[model samples]
Target: MDTKSLIIEKATILFQQKGYKSVGLTEILKACNVTKGALYHHFPNGKEQLLIACLQVLNEVIMTDIESIFRRHLSTKEALLSIIDKLIRDLETEGTITGYTFSSIVSEMATVSEPVRHACSALYENIQQIYSAKLVTDGLSNESASAIALLMTASIEGAMMLCLTQQSSDPLKTIAKLLPKLLKDI
Candidate 1:
C-alpha cells in the first residue's frame, strides 16, 4: 500500500477499536509509523479527512465483496450464508468481532461530522441494496425483498455486536441458523 492507504489502514484499526474521539493523530501516526508531515501531505484537512478516507476505502472493499459474493452464489440464502460464514471465520481468526468501522464511527462522530456520517450512511444503503437485489432475484417483490434485506442487515450487525460482547461466536452461528427462515415464506 501507498503512504495514504497505509495510514488509513492503520488508522482504520485504531479508530474501530478506540472510536473517533479517543484516537489521536499522534497515535495514528505512530501506528502507521508516518511523520506528521507525511500525514498532512496526504490528508490536509487532518484527522476528519483521514477518517473519511478510511470510510471510503472500507466502502469500496465491502461493495466489491458484496458483488463478488452475489456473483458466486446462485441463491439469496446461499449468498447470505456465505457472508455469515465469512464473518464467522474472520471473527475466529482476527478476533475483530468488535471492529466494525461503521458501527464504531457512526456512534461516535455521526452528530459531529456530516461528511463522515454521509459516508457511513451511503455504505449501509449500498449494502442493503445489494442484499435486496438478491432477494428480488430470488422471486420476492421489491418491497418485501427490501424489507427483509433491512432486517437481515440489522440482525447481522447486532449479532456481530453480541459476538463481541459475549466473546464467543455462538451468537453469530445462531443468527446464521435463523437466517434461512427469514426467507422461507417468501
Candidate 2:
C-alpha cells in the first residue's frame, strides 16, 4: 500500500482493537512504522480525522459484505439466518469476537464527536437499507421490512456483544439456531 493507505490501514486496525479515545497517535505511528510527519502528511487534522477515515473504511467493508450476503441467498429469511450463522462460525474460528465497529466507536465517541457519531449512524442505516431491500424482494411491504431489519440489526449486535463478553461462541450459535423460529411469524 501507499503511504496514505498504509496510515489508514494501520489506524483502522488500531481503532478496531482499541476504541477511538483509547488509542493515541504515537501508538498508531509506531504501529505503522511511520513518523509524525508522515502521519500529518496523510492526516492533516490528526487522530480524529484518522478515526473518521477508519470508520469510513469499516463502513465500506461491512456494507459491501452485507450486500454480498443478501445477493447470495434468494430467500430473505435464509439470507438473514445465514448471516447469523456466519457470525457464529467466525466467533468459533477466530476464537474471539470484537463488538461491531460502529457499536464500539459510537459507545465511546458518540457524545464527544458529532462526525464520528454520524458516520456510525450512516453505516447502520446503510446496512438496514440493504436488509429492507432484500426483505422487499422476499414479498414483505416496505414498512414491515424496515422494521424487521431494525430488529435483526439489534439482535445481531446484541448476540455479538454477548459472545464477546462471555468469551464463548455459544450465545451466537444459540441465536443462529433460534433466529429462524423467531422470524417464522414475521
Candidate 3:
C-alpha cells in the first residue's frame, strides 16, 4: 500500500477495535509507523479526516458484502439469514465482527464531530438502501421494503452489540431465525 493508504488502513483497524473517541492521533501514527508530518501530509484535518476516510472504506466494503450475499441467494429471506449466520460464525470464532465499526463510532462521536456523524449516517443509510433494494427484488413494494430494511438494519446492529456485550452470538442467531420468518411473508 501507498503511504496514504497505509495510514488509512492502520487508522481503520484502530478505530474499529478501540472506537473513534478512544483512539488518538498519536496512537494512529504509532500504529502506522509514520510520523505526524506524514500523517498530516495525507490528512491535514488529522484524526477526523482519517476517520471519514475509514468510514467511506467501511461503507464500501460492507455494501459490497451485502450486495454479494443478496446476489447469491434467490430470496431476500435466504440472503438475510445467510448474512446473520455469517455474523454469528464470525463472532463465535473471532469474538468480534468486521464491517461494523460505525456502530461504535457513531454512538461515540456523532455529536462531537459533524464529519463523523455525517459519515456514519451515510454508512447506515447505504445499508438500509441495499436491504431495501434486495427486498424489492424479492417482490416487495418500495414502501414495505424500505420499512422492513430499516427494521433489519436497526435490529441487526443492535443484535451485534448484544452479541458483543453478552459474549454470546445468541442475539444474532435469534435474528437469523426470526428475520427469515418475518421475510417469508414479504
Candidate 4:
C-alpha cells in the first residue's frame, strides 16, 4: 500500500483496539513505522484527523459490505439472516472482535469530543439508511420499516457486545433465532 493508505490502515487497527481518545500520534507513528513528520505530512491535524479518516475508512467498508448483503435479491428477512450468519462466521474465525462500534464509541466520547461524536452519528445514519431501504424493499411502510430497522440494528449491536464480553457466541445464536421471529411481525 501507499504511505497514506498504510497510515490509515495501521491507524484503523489501533483505533479499533484502543479507541480514538486513548491512542496517541506517537503510537500510531511507531505502529506504522513512519516518522512523526510523515504522519504530519499526511494528517496535518494529527490524531483527530487520522481518527476521522479511520472512521471514514471503516464506515465505507462496513456500509459497502452491508449494501452488498442487502442487494442479494433475497427478501429482507433472508438478507438479514445472511448478515447474521456472516457475523457469526466472522466472529468465530477472528476469535475476538475488535473495532469501535459507532454507538458505543459515540456514547464514550460524545461528552468530550464533538467531531468524533458527529462522525459516529454520520456512520450510524448511513447504516440506518441502508437498513431502511432494505426494509422498504421487504414491503413494510416506510415509517414502520425504518423504525424496525433501527431496532434490529440496535439489538444486533447489543447482542454482539454481549457475546464479545462473555467470550461466548450464544448471543449471536439467540439473535439468529429471535431475528426471524421479529421479522414475522414486519
Candidate 5:
C-alpha cells in the first residue's frame, strides 16, 4: 500500500478497536510507520479528514464484500445466512463486525462532526440498500424488501454489538438462524 492508503488501513483497524477519541495521530503514525509529515500530506485537515478517509475505505470494502455475497448466492436467505456467518467469523477472528468502524467512531466524534456522521449514515444506508436490492431480486416487492432490509441491518448491527460486549458470537449466530425465517413467506 502507498503511504496514504497504509495510514488509512492501519487507522481503520486501530479506530475500529480503540475509538476515534482514543487514537492519536502518533498512534496512527506508528502503526503506518510514517511520519507526521506524510500523514499531513494526504490528510491536510488532520485527524477528522483522515477519519473521513477511513470511512470511505470502510464503505468500499464492506459494500464490495456484501455485493459479492449477494452475487454469489442465488437464494436471498442463503445470502443473508452467509452474511451473518461471515459476521460471526469476523467477530471471532478479527473482532470486527460490518459496521465496527461506525460503532467505535460514533461514540466519540459522530456527534461533533457533520462529515463523520454523514459518512457513517451513508454506509448504513448503502448497506441496507444492498440487502434490499438482493431481496427484491429474490422476488419481494420493493416496499417489503426495503422494510425487511432495514430490519436485517438493524438486527445485525445490534447483534454485533451484543457479540462485542458479551465476547461471544451467540447473538450473531442467533441472527443467522432467525433472520432467514423472515424470508419464508416469500
Candidate 6:
C-alpha cells in the first residue's frame, strides 16, 4: 500500500483500540514503522489530518458495504436483517464492535475537533440516506421511510454499543428479533 494508505490502515486499529486523543503521532509512527518526517510528508497537519483520513477511509468502506447490501436483490427488510446479522458476526470475530466503528472516536473528538465531527456526521447521514432510499423503494412513504431508517440505525448503534460493553451477543440477538416487529409498523 502507499504511505498514506498504510498510515490509515495502522491508525484505524490504533484509534479503535485507543481513542483518538490517547494515541499520539509517535505511537502511530512506531506502529507503521514510518519516521516523523515521513508521516508529515504524507500528512502535513500531523495527527489530526491522519485521524480525518482514517475516518474517511472507514466511512467509504462502510458506506460502500451498506450500499452494496441494499443493491442486492434481497427485499428491503431482508437486506436490513442481513446487515444486523453481519454486524453480529463481525463483532463475534473482532471481539469488540469498536474496531468496526468510528462512533466511539467521534464521540470522543466531536466536541474538540470540528473536522472529525463533520466527517463522522457526514458518514452517518449517508448511511441514513441509503436506508431511507431502500425503504422508500420498498413502498413506504418518504417521510415514514426516512424516520424508520433513522430510528432503526440509532437502535442498531445502541444495540452494538451495549453488546460490546456487555461482552455478550444476547443483546444483538434480542435486537434482531425486535427489529422485524418494529418494521411491521412502518
TM-score of 1: 0.94
lDDT of 3 by residue, 57-147 (tens): 8888888998899889988888888889889888888888855645888888899998889988998899899899989988999999999
Model 3 TM-score relative to the real fold: 0.96
**Residue 68 lDDT in model 1?**
97
- Name the best candidate (by lDDT): 3
Q: List TM-scores for all candidates, in order.
A: 0.94, 0.92, 0.96, 0.92, 0.94, 0.94
lDDT of 4 at 21: 72
Best by TM-score: 3
- Tens digits of per-residue lDDT, candidate 2, 50-84, equal 88888888888888888889899987778887787
lDDT of 1 by residue, 1-186 (tens): 899889999988888878889999999989989999999999999999999998988888888988899889998888989988888988899887434436878888889989999999988898899999999999999999989989988888888877877778888899899988877765
lDDT of 6 by residue, 1-186 (tens): 888899999999899877898998889999999999999999999888988999888888888888888888456678888888888888888787654567678779999999999988988888889988988887899998899889878878788778877888777788789877866654
- Deviating ranges (above 4 Å) for candidate 5: 95-101
Report the candidate with higher lDDT, 4 versus 6: 6
How far does residue 24 in candidate 1 sit from its true spot (Å)? 0.7
Cα displacement (Å) at residue 29, model 5? 1.0
lDDT of 4 by residue, 1-186 (tens): 898899999988877666677788888888889999999999999887887788888789888888999898477788888877887777788855554344445656767778887887788888888888878887889998889888878877887778777878789788889878978865
Question: What's the distance in Å from true for residue 69, model 6?
Answer: 1.4
Q: Could you tell me which 10 consecutive residues in candidate 5 have the lowest summed lDDT?
A: 95-104
Model 4, residue 170: displacement in angstroms? 1.6
The lDDT, on a scale of 0 to 1, for candidate 4 is 0.79
Taken over the whole model, the C-alpha lDDT of each candidate is 0.86, 0.80, 0.87, 0.79, 0.87, 0.84
Clash pairs, candidate 5, are none
